[model samples]
Target: MDDTGLLVIVDAANVVGSVPDGWWRDRRGAAERLRDRLAAEGVPGHPGPVEIVLVTEGAARGVESVPGVLLDPAQGSGDDRMVDLVAEAGVFFFFFFFSDRELRRRVTSLGADVTGPRAVRPAGGAWAPRRDG
Candidate 1:
């Protein structure tokens, strides 16, 4: 399959929250790290220069979109935005999220393939913020 034809819509908050990295402290930092890693890795099974749309909300709101990654900040709920993305995706596009049961149901109902946050990264690492003494 043509990987470039694929579109990855990610639930930034859910993905970031998947790991217990103290993301609650510096959500922007965590989201930024996720974005950089995604830019570097381009998702797990997907190929490149892949397309990634990351949806952010709450503390991680206002994350800017860069080349290769589209940072979508939800006006209210990230889950709702994800649903809208799935509803609007083309035939070849797919959806990626962490663990929102309702979201999974919604996206799948739209006939879109879905995967976990691991699709972005293995899970772990300095997802947390570092504080100096």
Candidate 2:
């Protein structure tokens, strides 16, 4: 896909925390799952090509990037890193997925359009098992 489309920055912690699906037990796994989902589904609303960056921190820092999803491990705070990304990519149209009020305000001030975790989370609040049989 072209890199010229919208930039989607996903806050790993925030999005994972949005669903209490025992993610606290395996933060890295949770982040990895999010990365894989982004790789498979892309963003729900934006059907165009998008450069998805999953910002990870704390225990989820080492989650690696896949084909479509890029992992950015924050040195300090994921929110700060996301804000920096928004500021750096000021040219591209941005769609940020996270629910922190302060983070939302910070990114919005930097010209980023913000959405909550629901933007990336599963429709039923929990992931359903894929049935390909």
Candidate 3:
């Protein structure tokens, strides 16, 4: 299958919250680190071709711009924005990292294929799909 039609939506806060490394103490730093890791992974084209969007609440205070990585700062709820993105991003293969049952249900209701928890590396790093069961 052509991977070009794939779209990835990252729940920045969720990802940060998943790890117990005091990420909440420094949200901006955590986000920046996540963005850097994601950029290195080459999102849309990693493992296959896919467009990626990183959704976060508030401003992206410390994150830098990276090609193929769209930073979306939600004014209200990131989940709402994610739903909107899924609605508008066409019939591409959608993947999200939210672990919330309701949010996951919402994403799936929108017909997105979701994944989770694994460490997503840059282009040259290993790519292993996170198993959620």
Candidate 4:
């Protein structure tokens, strides 16, 4: 329905913390799993022109770029990187894994939509508009 392009930013650590599956025990594995899930071929229900980015603390150390995704390593905190991405992503539906309310407020202030750290269904993920209720 919306014609705007969407940018989905995944806070790797925050998303891993969303579930109590002990993802912290295997950080890389969890990140990889999330990436794979997002990259799953032929999945249904993704809206138009969706772009996914994964932000993690020190996770992008050696990795430069992913084929269908952008990997960002947080110098201090992944939240900062996420915010920066939202700010830089001009005119796109921005969605990020929501863990901290403060960070959510900051992203909304920058006029970017936000989404959840919840389990991403095969259809797609949950996202909310930045300005509209």
Q: Report lDDT (Cα) of residue 97, candidate 1.
A: 63
Candidate 1 vs candidate 4, lDDT winner: 1
Model 4: per-residue lDDT, tens digit, 21-132? Answer: 6565666666766666667641234546677777877643333445766677778877887888777766656667767899999999998776677635323332221232
lDDT of 1 by residue, 67-91 (tens): 7789999999888888888776656
Residue 102's lDDT within candidate 1 is 84
The TM-scores, one per candidate, come to 0.86, 0.91, 0.78, 0.76
Tens-place lDDT digits, model 3, residues 1-133: 2556667789888876776766666676677777777777555434777666888785554465577677888778988888888888767588787687888998798788887645453333332333348
Candidate structures ordered by TM-score, highest first: 2, 1, 3, 4
> Mind giving the per-residue lDDT tens digits that candidate 2 earns over 6-120?
8999998999899977888788878887888889999997888789999999999988889999999999988889999988876648888888999989988888888889989
Query: How many Å off is the CA of 133 in candidate 2?
Result: 21
* TM-score winner between candidates 3 and 4: 3
Global lDDT of model 2:
0.86
